[model samples]
Target chain A: MEEKLSVNHLLGIKNINQNDIKLIFKTADNFKTVINRSIKRVPSLRDITVANIFFENSTRTRVSFELAEKRLSADIVNFSSTSSSVSKGETLIDTVNNILAMKVDMVVMRHPAPGAAVFLAKNTNTQVINAGDGTHEHPTQALLDAYSIKEKLGDVKGKKIAIIGDILHSRVAISNILCLKKLGAEVMVCGPATLIPKYIGSMGVKIEYNLQNALKWCDVANMLRIQLERQDIKYFPSLREYTMQYGINLQTLQNLEKEIVIMHPGPINRGVEITSDVADHNQSIILNQVENGVAIRMAVLYLLAMKKTENVKN
Target chain B: MKKRILLDSNHTKIMLRRIAMQISETHGNLDNCAIIGMQPRGIKLAKKLLELLTEITKNKKIEYGELDSTFYRDDFRKGDKFLIPNSLNIDFLIENKIIILVDDVLYTGRSVRSALNSLGDFGRPLKIELVTLVDRKFNRELPIQPDYVGEEVDSRAKDIVEVIWAEENSSPEVWIITDK
Candidate 1:
């Protein structure tokens, strides 16, 4: 099989087809083995350097990408919005170009503005990976989520996935829907009426406002983080009200007809989006998702680096 | 294109069986020996050898695994062609065990080098041995040799040696193709 990935940079899941996703998952499979080994490091990208350029606050994605870079034996330079010259009113392109002048091979970026990665990709010669661009897309997160689903359920095709909560501002939800749908899985969005986008149903996803129906219908329920930081106006009544109607608790999970996998894109709102009991349930693969994030990011970096080197050879 | 049969199905089976016997002779009872097939083509050969060894010795205690050397290769991202990685499915620890690395062809010895690096990531082996079905003599870029070879074939740079297996083809045949 030819390893030529369809895209140079994973800007969004929207541009990738089933083959590309499968290829990433396949590459992730090898990386998953690498991480589980005793040495847990490969010199595949020994000379290559990666930059984790985060213009927004992050814990898992930043740390995961750094760890992936380290595990691949790639040189890493981390840039954060607070510490970088962007705090001194330096523009995005100027900052990235300045970093590129230092010989960075790729940039894994998360910015607060939507299309931030796309903008940087257009402006820079270095490869741009969209870690999270506002609520636009976090392609790696989506890939890891899909990979985790495939891991837990043995496959993703023909499986029912309900992405619950904060659909309006959840990049994880958007990316997961596209990824799951691309992999032949049925995806439905479940959130409050105000929180769910009006035309999200047009994207071939069934919209369910009720939590019980969503949980009952899905083989996996991915509860997205409610973006309190991104919200300018109140989208829901209160945390208590949202938790009462939409939160995934032990009682709600026990009431379901069959067992379903629980997922969260983390820094969970605890009692708000999911209760502690259900989050700690053996069925919840939140930590597995985080662990797979490292492998998935490694796969992404490794494949993109291969393409870059192949292009250089050409 | 002119094709010459280096080994037919019968010859291939005999060679594999002889190699299995040779392995059993070296490490009797085969308890601590782990057979790792370098992936894609090597895996098929390793699986066949493991089956034969198990049947001949009636010892099903030998550990067998497949190791993909794509990520461990030095030419991984340096080539014009995109490199697709194969499966690495080793479940047991290779620590302090006699490791037999199996591959179908030994041309440049780079693949075996990568396999050694990959095996290092797993665990330290007590002793490592190389087993190749077709040992292309005089084509090595590195100082690596197979401990067990099925057939030592001398071929030019333009010649292509291929192992046609029933797993991927209609019949098993080793063909040497030359442009005439």
Candidate 2:
């Protein structure tokens, strides 16, 4: 049973197959058990070194990747563009190549430009894990989200998952849609017309305008954070009006006859994307998503490290 | 390529009864003792041993656990094949209890070494005893040996000694194959 992932680099959720997703989930299951133990570190990647290269500002994603690397017992090097030679106009390839000079085995990268991780994978020989690239795809986030869904609901198949709030500027939304769809879940993207992407319909997901209607029809609702930093022009007239139209609150959940699982990729915009009460609701799996993030990232790194044995195979 | 029967099902059952009696004689009533099966293949041997142990000592029973040592193995990235892990189901505590670590074959002594390392996670055991269906002699890479063995065979390191214990294809038997 040589159950390995199809792709070498975790560029995005779009680049991996269904079996790759399943393999990742299966590996994550073991790591999940390890993390809950008295001693939470594994010696699987003891000889490997991973560098986290972030060309953008982040809190949760950066910390999650770092913690995942640490838990695997892998030596890690963290680089943020604001503090590195990147601020002095050093190219991505040159910066990464310099780190590679130090014998780094793998890279977990988040860049402001889309396809930056893809370009890095092409130029470098080491395995590249896309932490996040622009608003393209956060594959690990999507993976952890699906894993959490499976953990909560027993399975991801035949589940109706509604992705609410800003869809156009979320890598998490794209990755989640691709992952959930691959796992045989029904996905529906909901938001204001301006905040939603025009190309979303091509992804084979249902589009809905009414928040209450979408909520009533789905088994899970994943609320996305509005990327105000990436927004140049006004997508909506006012935050207050957008909250009134798209935000999920305790009332929205209570009005439904069936309870729905609530999820958020963190650094949540409290009253804007989801109210405090709903975010902390009993049915909310927001915290479980955070813990699963480490396990999922560990699985990705460990599987990719398994590829290194193949490097010496020939 | 070749095949040989070291022990048939009838002999295997009788050998299991003898080993179960030995275990009962060593630790009478099985108090403060537990049975642990190394995962992937040792689980089958462990299950059979537990059934026989229960039959012989009807009043005493031991908790059974499946331990996977893939993560603790010294050869993580050093091997040609990737280590695929099996599920660990050691729910009961092994603290201060005797653990009879069971496996199908004892070769290289590496798996047993890693298994000993893995047993540390589920609390410290008072002692650990090794049990095996076959022990490949004169091919040891580490200073380790099984306490209880059904049979010991001497063969070339390059040759293969396979134990086909039914279910998948043939009946319960062991084979030693050499390249032509």
Candidate 3:
């Protein structure tokens, strides 16, 4: 009944220091144990309702959050953009208020517009978990990425991380860059000149366009999924040209540091952004990121719900 | 809070000796037997058992491992972060080996459920026997019973047992810290 953690409300990784990350990792480690059992369900969030509001289409992130809610024993009400009143021109706030009227305890929202989750949090009494908000942030994905890296590399501090692909359109890359930098890792963003933004370097990240240079200096090469939706805007000459230049393949990987861990935020575009061999390789933490996603989200939800309950009681 | 001495250091040492003797008599020898201590105080208790059992059986080959049920707890996501020590250094294979799962307290049988979950990550054991230093009754939510209990205490829901080891509290004692 004591106040726990609500890590999703964490707006920026810049505010979180090493000790905070350690606490999150420690808490996530405990939840990892809860997931391995035959009877994995816990009564922590019993009778609590969590709304899954997605203003976009998804498979793994959506299902992972739903499963996380169920595992915590919370009732789920899923709202998709296609089925909701958004199709009828209703605003995001109006739809959220409608769900709030039903007394949902928490809302996990993913929208195409940046700052949508933050906006919902300001308007609603319920806790807002940013599953993904346009190109702004996906905190849980970043947390799981950090967790996966910590599990493999023992510590992320001083580790050189090369985040390659469409840096401008990738929420995953943005989150990972912020998180990795906060945890004391030197982050590098490398991609085609059109795809990589120049201002991202202001976030204290080093920018590189040459994949060979980025791959050589990095301890972790994180290949972000190139949002195909952004391709039509002339970000590159062509998909084949982009893959030929920047896609992490067997040849690029061979030139990379052998101990370097490969990572990707899923729904990978095979032969477009990354090669199948590197994605499926032993060094890849892509699947581990998915597994850690559930645990991290569970930790985030439990913490937020418990904190709100404590605030009300107080 | 009532200061109760369920099993003092001496009594615990003697009970561990007797348990070792019984195990040897029934299970042939202590060669294939491993003593796994549950996290926090259970690990210390198991280490103590290993020391006592070694003295009684005169077999120095008894393996000791520690298991942290922090990850395996049912209420893990529900509760506040209570930092405990890391997991056991279990190197040997548990397959076909007799495993004695040790814990400091047994109340509501939930911790044991967590311990069993923690055990499943390791290789399967031929036999797993649950042992607890204290067994408080009428709180079990699961169908689990400890194989060996050092002491049985009748308690209400408000009454909680705090087992302090010298490693943590600078002294070893079992006390009933009551809400009333």
Could you say which candidate leads in lDDT?
Answer: 1
Top-TM-score structure, candidate number = 2
Encode model 1's per-residue lDDT on A1-314: one tens digit a residue: 44678888899999888988888899999898889877899988998999899889999999999999999899999989898788799998899999999999999999989999989888889898999999899899999999999999999999999999999999988899999999999999999999999889888999999999888899999998888988899998898999999998899999888999999999998999999999999999999999999999998998899889866865
Give the per-residue lDDT digits (tens) of candidate 2, residues A103-196.
9999999998889999999998888999899989899999999999999999999999999988999999999999999999999999999988
**Candidate 1 chain A, run of 10 with poorest lDDT:** A1-10
Candidates in descending TM-score order: 2, 1, 3
Give the winner by TM-score: 1 or 3. Answer: 1
Error of 3 at A290 (Å): 2.4
Per-residue alpha-carbon lDDT of model 2 for B1-180, expressed as tens digits?
A: 766666787776777777888899998868778889998888888988887887777854478889988878888878776776788888888889999999888889999999998788767899999998889978899999998888898877987887677763222476777875
lDDT of each: 0.90, 0.88, 0.77
* Model 3 CAPRI quality: incorrect
Ranking by lDDT: 1, 2, 3
Q: Which stretches of candidate 2 lie over 4 Å from their true place?
A: B59-61, B167-171
What DockQ does each prediction reach against the true complex?
0.76, 0.66, 0.15
